[model samples]
Target chain A: MNAIAPSFPAHVQTGALSIRNLSKTYPLKGRPVPVLQGIDLDIRPGEFVSILGASGCGKSTLLRLIVGLDPDYQGQILLDGQPLNGPGLERGIVFQDHRLFPWMTLQQNIALALKNHDLGTAQKQRLVDEHIALVGLRGYEQAYPHQLSGGMAQRGAIARALVNKPKVLLLDEPFGALDALTRVRLQQELQRIWVQERCTVIMVTHDIEEALYLGDRVIVMEANPGRIGEQVQLELAHPRQRDTALLFQHKQRLLAQLVGH
Target chain B: MSPFKALTWLVSPLALLALWAAVADAALFPANLLVPPLEVWRSFADLLATGELQEHLAGSLSRLSLGFAAGALAGLAFGTAMALSDTVEAYCAPLFHTLRQIPSIALIPMLVLLLGIDETFKVVIVAKTAFFPVALATVEGIRAIPRSHFEVAAVYRLRWPTLVARIALPAAVPAIVTGVRVALTRAWVVLVACELLAADSGLGQMIEMGRQMLRIDVVMVGVAITGVIGFALDFSLRRVERRLSGWQVAGR
Candidate 1:
C-alpha cells in the first residue's frame, strides 16, 4: 500500500501530465453546478493510468478536460510542464462510440490524423499502415466503419488516434459499448499497444476489472460534485493475468468503495 | 442493366400506353383531345426529323444547366455562411424561410410583370427554384454533423481549410446531395412551367404552340418528352448521389 510515485526510465523524457487544483462547474439553469471538485493528478511518462467511477462522477469530464476538448476548467492541466490552451496534435483521444468518419475507408481514416503533420506521403502511409497493423486491422484497411463490427471500428479509432504518435492518449470508456468478450480481448490488445507505444495514457471507465487490468494506478472517483475518492497501485508487470488474486482483491475493494458509501 | 430491371421499368410505360390506345380506340372524350400513342410517337419522329424538337430540347437543357449552376452555387455559399455564422443566420433565416414558402409556380405571374417574360426572367425563375431547397438542406446538414467529428478535428488540430474540405464537406454531402437533387428537378419543372406561360422556344412553348394550332399530337409528344427527360435527369442524379455516398450506401 505504498502511496509513492512509480519509478520511470530516465531516457524516455516525454509525456508527463500534471493537473493542479482542477475544478469545473457547468451552469445549470443560470446556477453554477459543480462537476469536478479540486481534482489534482500527476502521471509519469509512459505510464498507464485508469480512472474508475460511476456515472456522473466527472470521470469522462476529466478525460475531456485532459484532452483539451473542454478548456473551461478552473485549474491547470500541464503537459511537459506547459499549460494547454486547446487541443493539439500532442494529445489524442478515443471516444466510447467509435467516431470514425463513415465516409473514409479505414486506412484513409487513420491517415486523416496525420493531415497536420509535416511528413511526406510515404512516411504518412507507413505510419498509417503500422498503426493499422498495431491495432490488428491490416487486411481490413479498405473497409468502412459500418462494414466493421463495433469492436473492429473501435480498434480502427485507436489506430487513428495513435497514428500521430501522440504523447498522451486519452480514452473515454473506449470499450464501453462492446460486448463483454470483445471488451476483454480489446483490453489485452490495448495493453499491448500501450506497452509498444510507451506513451502516457489515461483511460476512464466504469468497468472494475478493465481498470485494474490495464492501469498501473487506478484512481477511483466519487460523485456529487465529483472528487477523487481513493487510488490503488498495481505493481504487476505488463501483459497482466486477469486471474491474479491481487487483481481480484483490488476489484473487491474498489467495488465496496464504489457502492458501500 | 439486367433484363429483369429493364422489364420492371417497362411495365408502367407499357400499361399506360395500352390504356391510352384503348381509350383512343373507344373515342373517349374526343379523338382530338386523347390523341393515340402511335400518332404521338409519329409526331415525335416527324419533329425529330425536322430538327425543331432538337432545338427546343437543347435550349431547355442549356437553360437548366446555366440557371441550376448559378442557383446551386449561390445556395451552397449562402447556406454554409448562414450555418457557420450566427450573425448571418440571425439576419437571413426568417426571410429565407418566408421566401422559400412562396411556390415558384405562384411567382411566375409577378416575375413576368417584373422581368418581362424574357430569357432573364426564365433563368431567374429557374435559379429561384434551385436555391431554397439546397440552402435549407445545407443548413440542416451542417447543423446535424455530430459534435464528435468537430472534437476529432480539434484533436488533430486541423486547419480551417482542411476542416472544411475533409470534415465539413464530406459530413454534409449526403444531405447536400439530396437537396441538390430536389433543387435540380424542381428547377426543371418550374422552368418548363414558366416557358408554358411565356417563351420564344422550349418544350413547354412547343406545347403551347401545339394547343393553339390544334395539334394535340404535338402537345402529347411534348408531354411524353418532358416526362422522359425528367426521369432521365432524376435517375442520373440518383446514380451520382449513390456513387458519392458509396461509403455509407455501398455496403448496406
Candidate 2:
C-alpha cells in the first residue's frame, strides 16, 4: 500500500452528462404505467452525484439508462457530445450484486473489463493490478468471488468497474448489501478512490447518510412518476469527515424529503 | 476419511454379502440354480486365465466408446441449436420430449427389428440410450445461464467466438459435464443389454452363452463383473464431475 495518497487528476476530459425530458413507462397488465416522467439532470465532469430516493423510486432506472444497460426510454442522454445508444467502455457500472463471474479470480474479473481495449499485454496487466490495489484488494488478486467476504466481493466489483478508467462510473446501490460497518468503511474507501481517479460518479442509493457522505450534490427523488424532489449541495470538501454537521444536516433534510410529510 | 472410519461404513454391505453367501450355500434351492460367490469368483478366474473375459470386455468397451461418441456429439449440437433459436425449439420440442419419454430399454425390441441382430443394431441402441439425457441436460444448462451474462458480453462487445469460448462454454460446463456423466452410465448399461439380446461377441454374449450352457457359476461371474465395471465407470465420472464443478463447491 502506498503511504502517499494519490491526488485527483486535474486535467480530466470533462464530459457533460445531460439527460433531457427523460421518461420511462412499463407495461403492467396491458396498461402503460409511467415510472419516470419529464426528468432532466446535468452532471458535471468529475462531480460526484448521488440520487437518493425511496424503494419504489426510479433512481436505479435512471442510473441504468445513463449506463446504457436499459435503452428503452423517451429522451436524449448525451455523454460529452455523443448520443448514448448502447453501453460503452466510457461508462462503467457497479451493480447491487457484486456480479463478479464466480469462476474468475479478482484479477481476471477486473481484466475482463479491458478485453476490448487495444493495449499491450503488460499495460493491461498493470491496469488490472493497479485497480485491484486501488480498491484495497492488493493481495486478493487471485482470490475467487466465493472466497471473499461481502465487502471484499463488492470491492472487487468496484475494481472491475473502475479498471477501464471510464468517463462516468454508475453505481446502483453498490454497498447496499454490505453490513453497517463494512458499508461505512467502503464509503470512505470509495471517496478515497474517487478523489484519486476524479471520474464523474453517479450513484443510486436509498441511504440518506450514504448519499450525503459520498455525493458533491445529493438529488432527492420522489416515486409515482419519479422525478427530482430537491437537490442539496454539500459545501464540505473532499475526503469528508463522516460526523460533520454539514453531512448530518443534509442527511436530515434528505430524510425529510424522502419520507414526505 | 480414515481407514477405520471407511471400514465401519462398509459393515452393513459386508454383513449383507455374508448373508447372501450363506443363503446360496444352504442348498435351500438347488446348488446349480443359486451359485455361491466363491464359485462365481472361481469361474471369473478361469475366464481370465483363458483370456475370454478380457476379450468380451474389450469388445463391449469398444462398442460403448463408438456409440457414446456419436450420440454425445449430436446431442450437444442439437441442444445448443434448440436453446439458441425459438424457431428450432418450437418445431422440435414436442417430438424431442416424446422421444425422451420412451425409455431406451423399452425400444430394444423395436430397434432390433428395424436394424436386425447385427453390430449396427446394438450400436444404434446404445447411441439412442446415450443421446436423450445429454440433449435434455444441455438444453436446460444453456437456458439456465442468466441473461446478465450475455449482456456483460455484449457490453464488452465480445465477438461471437470469444463469447462462446470465454462466457457461454464455461458458464454451461457444470450442466454439460453432468449430462455427459448421465449419458456414459446409461450407455454402458444399454450396450450390455443389447449385447445380451443380439450381439455374438461382448460380455452380455458371454453371459447369455453361460446361461444357455447351464453354467450358473459363469452367469454369476458375468453379473458380478458387470456390476464392478458399472461401479468403476460411475466412480470415475463422479471424480470428473467433482473436479469440473470445483467452483460450485466453493460457492456452497
Candidate 3:
C-alpha cells in the first residue's frame, strides 16, 4: 500500500478534467463525418456533470474523448493543467455493458485495475473488498459476470472503474441497460457514492430525468456537428430526493427541450 | 415413466446380443471370421491379464498428450500474434489459412513417405491435426473481445504485461479452452489413425495385428476399447469446461 501511493497517486488535488474546443470526425468511406464540433466543457474537482442529448447527438463521443479513449480528436483535453495525450489512471470509465472479464470472479475483475499498481496482495484484496462493498455487492465476491444480473454486473463495472480511485470517472449510460426501477435505485446509489468519494464524474445519457437527477450541471448537446446547445445548473443540495419540486421542474424543462416541446 | 416403458429400453440391447449369439452358434459364417460374445470377452480378459492392452493404451495416450500440448501452445501464440499485429496477419494469414484447408489425414501419406513410419511421423500428424482448429478458434476468440475492455485498460494506464495478463488472457479463456478441447479430440483421433498405419506398439497396432492373424475376437476387443477411451477422454474434457465456466450456469 505504501509503495502503491508512490508509483501512482490515485488521489491528488488537481483541477479535474477540462475539455476545450474538442472536435471529432469519423472517416466514412472517404469523406469525414463530423460528430463533435467545437465542444467546450469543464468538470470541476468533485463535481458531478452530466451531458444529456438525444440519439446521435455525440454525447457519448464527448465522454470518450474526455476519458482519452478515442485520441483521434482535434482539440486539447487537459487534466490538472496537463495536456491529455492518452488514457491515464487518473481517469476511469464505465461503459454501457459491464465489461467485466467473463472468466474472472467479481473479486478478480474488480482487482484487475490494481494489477499495474505496486500494491501487495493483502492491500489489493482490501481495495477490491472496499469497492465491492461500496457498490453494495458484498457477499458475491467469487461470483462470475455470468452469475450476476444486469444491474449487478453494472455495479461490478462501477466497482472496477472506481477501484483505481481516478481523478475523473467517465460513464456512458452506465444504467441504461437496467430496468426502470433498478435504474432509479442505482441513480440514488451513484449520488451517494459520488458524495462520499468526491471524485469528479462526467456521464452521458439520453434520459432527461436521469440527467436532472444526477448532474450538478447538465449540458444539452445538439446533433449534426454535435455542439452544446444549453447548460442547466441544478443548484440543488446533495442527497436530493427523487420527487422534489425542483427535480420535477427541471425534468419537465429538460424533457421539453429534448423533445422539442 | 411407466415401468414397462423403462423395461423396453433395456430389452433392445439384450435382444441384439441374443441374436448375435444365435447367429454365431448357428455357424452362419466361418468360425475364424465370426467370434461369439463369450469368446470375445475371454480374449479381452486374457489381454487385460497379460497387460498387453494397458501397454498399448498407455503408449497411445502419452503420444496424444505430448502432441496436443505442443500444438495447442503453439497455436495460441501464433493466433494471438496474428490478432495483435496487422503485418503478421496480412502476410501470414493467407498462407496459414490455405495450409489449414488441407485435411490433416490427407497429409498422412506424404508425411509417411517423407519421414518414414516412425514416432516422429505419428506425432507430427497429431500436432498438425491439433494445430489448425485451435489456432482458428483462438483468432476468433481474440477478435471477439469488445473494444470497451481495451478502453478500460487504456484508461487505467495498464502496462503491457498487466494488460495481457489481466484483461486479454481472462477474456480469451473460454475460447482458448474450447480450442484446447478441439485440439485434444483431434489429436486423439489422428494419433490412433497414425498408429493403425505405422506405429510399432499402440491400440490401433494391436487391432491391425489381430486382423493379420485372423483373430476377429481380438479385433472386436480393440474396437470396443478405442470407442470407450475416446468417449472417456471427451467426457473428461467436457467436465473441465463445465467446471471452469460454472459461474455461467449458476447465473442462468
Q: Please, what is the TM-score per model?
A: 0.94, 0.92, 0.90
Q: Return the TM-score for candidate 1, rounded to 2 decimals.
A: 0.94
lDDT of each: 0.90, 0.86, 0.84
Candidate 1 DockQ, CA atoms: 0.71
The global Cα lDDT (0 to 1) of model 3 is 0.84
What residue pairs are clashing in model 1? none
lDDT of 1: 0.90
Tens digits of per-residue lDDT for model 3 on B87-198?
A: 9999999999999999888999999999999888887888888888888887888888888777767777877777766766666767877887877877887787788888
TM-score of chain A of each: 0.96, 0.94, 0.93
Give candidate 3 regions above 4 Å deviation: A1-12, B1-19, B249-252
Candidate 2 fnat reads 0.39
Looking at model 3, residue A205 earns an lDDT score of 92
Which has the greatest TM-score? 1
What lDDT does candidate 1 reach at residue A203?
94
lDDT of 3 by residue, A56-123 (tens): 88988888887777879998888878998777777888988888877788998888788778899999
